[model samples]
Target: MELDRISNLENDITQKIFSYLSIKEAARTSVLSKNWSHKWIVPPCLVFDDENGLSTETIVSHVLLLHNGPIDSFKLSSRKDLDPNDIDQWIHYLSINSIKEIIVKKRNRYSSSYSISSNLFSCQDLTHLELYNCLLQPPSTLKGFGMLKSLHIRRVTVTRDVLEEVISHSPLLEKIILCKLGIRHLKIDAPNVSFLELRGGFEDVELENTINLVEVSIDQKRGSTNSSSLLKFFFKLPRIERLTLQDSFLEGANGSLPKKLPEPCLCLNFLSISIRLNNLEDISTAMCLLRSSPALQELEISVQQDQHVADAAEVTGWLNDKQNRPFTQLRILKVTGFSCVKAEMDFIVFLLLSSPALQQLEISFGRKAVEVVDFSWIYDNQNNGAFMQLRLVKVTGLSGSKAQANFIRILLSSTSTTLERLTLQPAASAKELWELFKLLGEFINRVSVPAVVLEFLDPSNSVQESDDSSSSSDSDDDIGF
Candidate 1:
């Protein structure tokens, strides 16, 4: 006697409601109603993952045969049993159906990689394309993806010409991510690309015409190319807002670095730079980036761990030049791999006093997840800045030494004006959490401002997730990237 309202709904409404459910979950709903079972409106986004025991070849063929209307997105995540010939056929069908996105992550035991055929290029409706571990040969008649906005190619074997053709032809492309391309030279002259994440080896990078590019991250997978100077390289990215330099990309700057870029990154807002604390060149490069980013609001500095850092006495005088000026806009700062060495202390202290507007500070350091023993670290006692703007201070992997306790004591004592929260995570599950508090006496509760929140985090939190996702080719942890 009851009417099947859901089943009787229009096709457009059905698609809208069912689009949120996964393909398998949508299929499971077939038992709810026989009418729904007979005329199932599949979602436009199809992900034929062979991660489970599902046979993609048969399932995909049937889906295309039975399903009507356009497929907006398709991802063929292959672990095995994905025939190369099947790819061309599926892409051909998808091209006719106006597919908007294609993600082919091929990991086949039967073949080295799936050679992407001309059928894919026919999908003129594609806007987002990602191909990993595949062979791409640009079709002579390639008209390019005129509507494409995001292009991600990782571990794919596409010639430099073909790659450039794809980038240059995609007039609307905004995000370009390339990793381990194995290409020695890359000339990116795209007019509209805004975000670029380039990793792996690039002998020469041409970016003169990318005037609209805003965010750029480059990590040299191998050693520096020594082909481009820092001045010449950074001058092109005058509008970059966020920058991350990893590995040896900024090591020597191809020879020498100017004291400052003639034209600084006037728009830069966030910077994450990796460096070695003892290496003069690395420190110099790190400081160069800081000084150039006059508008910088957030900064993350990751130091190379497990090395003998030079004594602060040796590095402090050279570092006292106050090169970290113009960080008046800086609000947040984070440092990782900070051993309680005097050099690390000096750098932190120098930065702390430099940014009068600095608000939050987080420091995480330790070679391992073991309880910290007092290193008997000694530093020249200096008065802390007013820190009138500093609010939140979090220190992880802290070695519970009287010296470290005194360091916290000084920060707490001076931040009486604006300090709000203090979070401490020990190197391991150390009983020294209590001992450190005892060493501070009743000073922890004496902040003159409003209540100061104190939190003791688990030491395990100090050890970052051990999963090496950056080097993983198959991991989809960073889907957006």
Candidate 2:
């Protein structure tokens, strides 16, 4: 038989080949020769997600014992619980070899949470750390992760004080995400931290010193309406450029909300916030941030689907308030999770009227409309003073409802002169698709904008919005302009 070219390749090229193999598969290559033996034993990355816990643990231990080179990353994922003691030994060994990244994900969350090895904190060269459904108990001697740049903890259990200690002590930490953690009274003092995302039921949040903090997203299960806490938190982010606050985050302001932040977010160009039509405090907070964000260009508002939608009077009063007029610099406005509420429509009109620089408007309904959505108010306002700057309007989550068709009808009438594109995305299922397209197509024939191309995103072929910030859960789906 002729000699194999792959086997005779250079060590660098061989290393590349071995990188694609699993640890077990790579280890089996040792039977080839002594040269192949050493390559398999020293893989640059080790990812263990085997179903059999005992075997996985034994194999990992055996691999580490025979390992002789630096590993770029180590990931330990398991469906069945593995002994934390074994994990400790592995972490200690990886620490000595200068591992740069560590990810431990426990798939079975219904069972007991994984107690991570304290030795993990000793990995001084670690730059990225992600722990899911794990408990982090750093030793008292732990100073900080000197080279750590990103720390992500999801469904992890750590004391408020311990987490604070880990975050504040890390000098190089830039990105921190604490999601669905069962802890409270979180305090962050990361001076170098730029992106911060907190999504949980935190009783309190304190930002001691986040001077470099810019992008922030908070989707709290329950948000306090305390003015002092809100003010103190907002005052620290002078350089915030992008912000998204969703769910019940800062839902109510305890009857006393700040009119505006003293230090404006002058650098902020994108702002996303949750709004409750009935909650004046929520509206007030949204307005406060809008007023403070002078440089804001993109605005996204998620209208909470609350049954107690505010009356037209309350929406009118807030719109008429001089201080509440928002987004003078706003170019793109996106509204989502809207049900056909009188106040919701009124608020949309208010935004259209207030935002003179607005160019693109997008609205995604939360549910199929039960009644026809009246857009006569906007149709009449078109003659008085229209959004001349408006260029594109998109409406998604359509189910061929009379309400949606009527809204599109009004949009076509209002944007006939300036609109370049009118995009509609139906939320109907495969069975209902034909009916939806038929209704919309017929409606467009009767009520269409002049010379404007109509676009429809077929549900079957539609691509789901990615995790990118432009199409984030808190922002509008990124339809490229």
Candidate 3:
């Protein structure tokens, strides 16, 4: 009966196992039964976290004794007290055994320097290497790893010359992520790099040869004074499909070039951008960039000031100019976190009038300072042989006021047939909401066009009253407005 059970256990252990125990604890699994004696010999991957005060030398010796084949991956992160030599020995042993991927993390209270020896660079099978808070001597060349694809170095000091050498050697390299490397001048010549992420202090990075690049993300959090150098580098990105700029301290006043100039005429179909325009001068610079792209279908703009609204007329004129035709293919337009003042409202009206094919329009008001404007002229003009094609209008976070209510009434009155959906969330009682929905429904039924579907949603639904106590929370609350 025991022999049959052992055979059954062997058949049951077909899947791989991942464990976080010390090597000694892992070896004890051999004593579970005869079928498990050699279970620890051929783990596809080995991960050892020094949690139980295991010495690095002891761990390295145990790993050498157990690992006989090429390891698919090896990860070692030690925080306890251990000799640096022992850690170096473990890395050396793993490199000799042809480890394909390796991650080494050292967290000592005192700052210690752990250098990656030249032997590490000679690992021909290594495809991925990640190091955290470790020191690396300048690599002569990364030519040893002929198949290297991804390399990440964070919180380390890599000189510019060494960085250039490594990038020059990796012919098939696709992705490189660098953080806090203290690199002052970065020059990349790799022709096949597809993705590159650079963060830390402002460094003058030149990407003159990445022809097949698709995405680039730069985070400049160090508030460096070198704004012109960075802006020059940003404008030189030739064909990048996606670009993201975050936490840049070069607000236009500091003599930095306008953030919007030198725009790349990329075949970009989607764009999400945030600009810190402190004045109209900066806004004009940004408008120059917006005018460069006439094919954008979806646009999300988050402005930092309310005064930029005055530039809306110029923006609208730029869009409708015969030379710069409007984005006739635009379907969705969203503007958030700006007071819908008269200038902003007029800009939106301009877009609505220009974009004859727009289907959805969403404008989020920042505060209750400005009164909501009624854009019924768009629909009324359409009735007089105008060619407006709007279908849905949504106004969120509605304050119970006359201006907002009148805006809703004007929209319902204007586009009764073409306006198929209207979503309103008002801060009012359920009975008040029911009355508004009924009124709107009757108005739509009287029209010869299709009866528009008007939906009135209570702005507050999370107060948690009992179903019986809350008459407005019932299915009847969905009645047409």
> On lDDT, who's better, 2 or 3?
2
Q: Decide which is better by TM-score, 1 or 2.
A: 1
The parts of candidate 3 lying over 4 Å away from their true place are: 1-41, 47-65, 76-83, 105-114, 139-144, 233-237, 249-264, 277-282, 294-325, 328-481
Using TM-score as the measure, name the better of candidate 1 and candidate 3. 1
Count of backbone collisions in candidate 1: 0
lDDT, candidate 1, at 43: 67
Instruction: Assess candidate 3 and give its TM-score to the true structure.
Output: 0.62
Against the true structure, candidate 2 reaches a TM-score of 0.83
Whole-model Cα lDDT of every candidate shown, in order = 0.73, 0.73, 0.57
What lDDT score is found at residue 181 in candidate 2?
Answer: 79
As a whole number from 0 to 100, the lDDT of residue 4 in candidate 3 is 62
